[model samples]
Target: MKEENLIVRSVTKKKYSSYAGEITPATPNLIQRNFKAEAPDKK
Candidate 1:
């Protein structure tokens, strides 16, 4: 990408504050960092 003068656009991150101090259920990691794909360009 550098050779083609390509650049990556980044998203601006905003914080969510709903129920910030309340007790809530924990979120699960379904994939668990296993990002392998059977074919190229597939998630």
Candidate 2:
């Protein structure tokens, strides 16, 4: 029962989500966020 208290109880029972409410509306972004890179090997 040591190993640094089982790695601090497995990092305080880790489970995290910042998926921003898990986007819905039948989810389809497909780069529509337009991370613009018209050149440089098209990013």
Q: Which residue runs of candidate 1 sit more than 4 Å off their true CA positions?
A: 1-19, 39-43
Q: Which portions of model 2 miss their true places by more than 4 Å?
A: 1-27, 38-43
lDDT of 2 by residue, 1-43 (tens): 5855654334455588666765666877777878889787674
TM-score on alpha carbons, each prediction: 0.30, 0.17
| Residue-by-residue lDDT tens digits, candidate 1, 1-43 | 9899999999999887676686889899876898998998876
How much is the lDDT of residue 17 in candidate 2? Answer: 67
Best by lDDT: 1
lDDT of 1 at 33: 96
**Candidate 2 clash figure, as a count:** 0
Write down the TM-score for model 1: 0.30
Please give the lDDT score at residue 1 for candidate 1. 100
What is residue 7's positional error in candidate 2, in angstroms? 92
For model 2, what is the alpha-carbon lDDT of residue 41?
68
Cα error, residue 38 of model 1, in Å, equals 3.2
lDDT comparing candidate 2 with the true structure: 0.68
Candidate 1, overall lDDT?
A: 0.85
